[model samples]
Target: MTLGHSTRLIAVAFALAGPFGLASQPSWAEPTQGWKSYIERDYQAAEKHWRTDVARGNPNGAFGLAILAERAGDAKGATEWYEKAALGGVPSAQVLTGQRYAEGVGVERNPVRAYAWFARAMAAGVPNAEKLRDRLAATMTPSQIKEADALAETLAKP
Candidate 1:
């Protein structure tokens, strides 16, 4: 009878603990962990964990990968991952993509497209997007600025 009670208690404990343990493990935890490592400049570990998260289709992982690639001086890889993250709707990625396009970092310079993305990031309330937008506007000709504004307006619509 004592063994039966103990078995029941153990089963109950397992039942209660199992779901909590699983729930405590978030989908983003690994990617966040990788980001922590990246912030600490542990490039190898950051790449490893971030790659694991990327394999699971996490946009944050792609952002981390982009940062890591940039740190490693792999422009192509950084651009690709930044594109992936931006298309995934990561706001910071949108900002970085706009900056890249504006400067012709990995892709050709396209002020209209850069303005569109900066506008998107601005609408998304990323803190410094407006500053970048203003800076890009300053570098553009009146005609180019008009074109960029038009593109940004169109992109702002639902």
Candidate 2:
């Protein structure tokens, strides 16, 4: 589906929230609260809801908060939460974390680390991962690329 820049960003955040975007799963008794507020563009409400969810140790909530923080210009908050959710196996969050590392936005510059994250997210089957990996590779030396590939391989394992 086509999305505007803002919607596309939201979609990436929500894409991993459930099997579908902004739609709660039957597995949750109260439905996904963040999705509702996010769909309505009530980001403050969404942030509140996601914060609640995050406190409950929900990976989706962590991912949602990361996106909202990014939208709200809290790059550090976004980066922290993205790393948290990424470790929990949120593919989109993994991609976002990789991008952050690649750009040094709210994080230290580390191309090798960024390439590793892209590799991990790619292994997780995120869309456009191959393209992202290739783009970063262009800025890397052959040895750095090889190191990143190995690191990605290591991280990709269960």
Candidate 3:
């Protein structure tokens, strides 16, 4: 039985490795290449690859594409992609979307929405979010602050 189990494990490993071996590059290499293109300022190439990855449900790819859109001056596209990434649980995207809401960049300014997003990012452990949350708190009335805090607490719940 032990020998049979070991053989079965080895077979599964070989099956997984087969596709990787046959390809000149591993399947996961595309996302890395896409990120490198982004870092090198090749926005079009990065967008192409990242869009493909995003279509396949890659959260990092969605975040990268959103950031590229923002840097490329496509505010509408950036907002859409950033929202998608944030919904997909990318903390940086949540923080950026919140900042945009706070500053009235791309979208209309809405302090409540901004605070909610910052709170989400803070809950996710984005260290800078806490500072932003405090700053946002300073701009609100007591009731508004209480509302925002309640919203944040609700979002923090699993």
Off by over 4 Å in 1: 1-31, 138-158
Best by lDDT: 2
RMSD of 3: 15.1
Each prediction's whole-model lDDT (CA):
0.68, 0.74, 0.67
Q: Give per-model CA RMSD.
A: 15.9, 4.4, 15.1
Expressed as tens digits, the lDDT of each residue in 47-84 for candidate 1 is: 88878877877777787788777766777788778767
Q: Give the per-residue lDDT of model 3 (tens digit) for 52-131.
A: 87787666577677667666677877777766766666666677777778988888888987898788877776667888
Clashing pairs in 3: none
Q: Which candidate do you rate higher for lDDT, 2 or 3? A: 2
Residue 85 error for model 1, in Å?
1.1
Which residue runs does candidate 3 get wrong by more than 4 Å?
A: 1-31, 150-158
